[model samples]
Target: MERFYARERMGVQGSWSRHSAARVASAQALRGRDRLRAALSAMGFRLQ
Candidate 1:
């Protein structure tokens, strides 16, 4: 259980770093709808 928690924490941190990197790279390249979709996907949500 402890190991699971630790791994989950690390995963969250890694994803946060990647998310920031992606945001910076995509900030200018994505348009409004695409930006919204990206934001939703980043938050682990999907648009239907």
Candidate 2:
């Protein structure tokens, strides 16, 4: 896990399977097309 943070622009991608999140818009944030995927999943929606 230590090596994962060794990159110059270190960041985390994907959802936290064991936790919930609430994201807000910000300039530093990327274009997350799958951001709502987790919420949809909790509501019983499946993705391809």
Candidate 3:
């Protein structure tokens, strides 16, 4: 019914927000890893 649709819309919006936040966090982590790799290379470091 109408109530079900209303609640479903809210749930979808909440889930979308959660997914967006996770994506942002993941991108930041990836950038951090890239920076770490660059730093390690600059310092002549490598992992076997």
The whole-model lDDT of each prediction reads: 0.62, 0.51, 0.62
- The digit string of per-residue lDDT tens for model 3 on 1-48 reads 445547777443445556556645765656576477778878999855
All candidates in order of lDDT, best leading: 1, 3, 2
Which residue pairs in model 2 clash with each other? none
Decreasing TM-score order of the candidates: 3, 2, 1
Q: What residue pairs clash in candidate 1, if any at all? A: none
The C-alpha stretches of model 3 lying farther than 4 A from their native spots are: 1-25
Q: Mind giving the per-residue lDDT tens digits that candidate 1 earns over 1-48?
A: 445547777443444556566656764744464567778889999778
TM-score attained by model 3: 0.30
Off by over 4 Å in 2: 1-34
Ten residues in a row with the worst lDDT in model 2? 16-25
Q: Model 2: per-residue lDDT, tens digit, 21-48? A: 4343442342464467877888999977
Worst 10 residues of 3 by lDDT: 10-19
